[model samples]
Target: MNATQRTNERPGIEKNRIIRIENGKKAYLPLLLLADEQEDMIDRYLERGEMFVLEDGDRALAGVVVSDEGDGVLEIKNLAVIPAHQKKGLGRRMIGFIADRYRDRFHTLLVGTGDSPMTVPFYEKCGFARSHVVKDFFLDNYDHPIIEDGVRLRDMIYFKKSI
Candidate 1:
């Protein structure tokens, strides 16, 4: 089936639906980049992974990409909610949806994000504990420096939650 064809498989369950995208990762680029700023960095995992979009009726509110990172682990490569829909419990719901959907397939769910005042707390609140940190990750990986909440992002902080 095409990417848009299988969107509303469960119509009566809830208005907020999470649809898995098997192709066309680029179509959700604008939202994806909100979570991970660099386009080229996203390219490394976008097509090789699976994508999901959270939609409320006809409106797309958030998107996420997860990839099998080997050793029975699934990593969330990117997750972003539309600015207008932020802080509405949509992101936590999406994370819960992904965890439930992949629990039987993977032992754990991992998400790597930058060390930022704005992002780290949110992930921690989502039940993810800090597993490790990659020093100078953003400075070394991306072509340009990344800053969030007025602080320069220099480390890649990894968080994990067992499913």
Candidate 2:
């Protein structure tokens, strides 16, 4: 589908809808940064990845970027919900949308995130189980230390769920 094409799938909400952003995905960088903090890191996959945004009218409430990682694996490159709309199930809704949309095409949904109190529990709540860890991923990759919820992020904790 083109950039303007929107999916009819709704996450149990009438006004909010998910749309595939085929072009100009960087326009939502602010939202994307909420999940993946560094721009350079995002650039690694943003262009090749498929982006989806949850919108309430013209305002975007959340966004997710997914990439085909071969071997029937779809990795969530990034996912973020606006602070005002977070903790209100928008993130979960976005995940549900992705899982449902890719169920037939992919067998597993994967995500790598910092081992922060703020994120680990969230992914667990979304039905993801701890898979593996990439040692010192944040320290080795990011330009500087990434701190979340007063804890310095070190390893990249990977999570997976069967689609």
Candidate 3:
């Protein structure tokens, strides 16, 4: 994997152009689960310095909310590729870009998820496997339960890869 260390320090909290998202806009509701009806917490993470955005072509296509737990663990708190662009390998391409850019630097990469059919499979297809599950994940962490197609979620799954 090719790794580039841009001498520039990463953007600062106030200068971050990327914002955290709890969900895509309303029209995208069917494609993802809204972690909360109110997006404040996610916004705060963005403002406090923990989110990363990926762009393809001229538009932003995906993001990953990450927290550095240790030099060995980089947690991908959230990840999504807009529904309009699914199934075209854009998601895979972005993941490859990020993994290539960070694999040698970080010992491992982690991704977490609440109960969601679409997201779980997407992660699996990207070469992730279930590492563990946290009960009441959404209840304990999110202000509201994530519901999609009227199904409520209460657990979160973790996926990991050695980069």
Query: Which candidate's lDDT is highest?
Result: 2
Deviation from native of the Cα of residue 55 in model 2, angstroms? 0.8
lDDT of 3 by residue, 1-163 (tens): 2345554335443431343444433333322233334455455444433544554433556655566778677776545666676678766765665677667768777887766786788788988888999899777777766786577878878988777
Once model 3 is optimally superposed onto the true structure by TM-score, how far is the C-alpha of residue 3 displaced, in angstroms?
A: 41
Candidate 3 wrongly placed segments (more than 4 Å): 1-38, 47-51, 56-58
Stretches of candidate 2 exceeding 4 Å from the true structure: 1-14
> TM-score for each prediction?
0.89, 0.90, 0.68
Give one digit per residue, the lDDT tens place, for model 1 in 120-157. Answer: 89899999999999999998999987879888889899
> Which pairs, if any, clash in model 2?
none
Could you tell me the TM-score of candidate 1? 0.89
Model 2 CA lDDT for position 30: 93
Clashes of 3: 0
How does residue 110 of candidate 3 score in lDDT? Answer: 85
lDDT of 2 by residue, 36-59 (tens): 889999999999999999989778
Q: How does model 1 fare in lDDT?
A: 0.89
- Cα deviation at 63, candidate 3, in Å, is 2.3
What's the C-alpha lDDT at position 14 in model 1?
A: 74
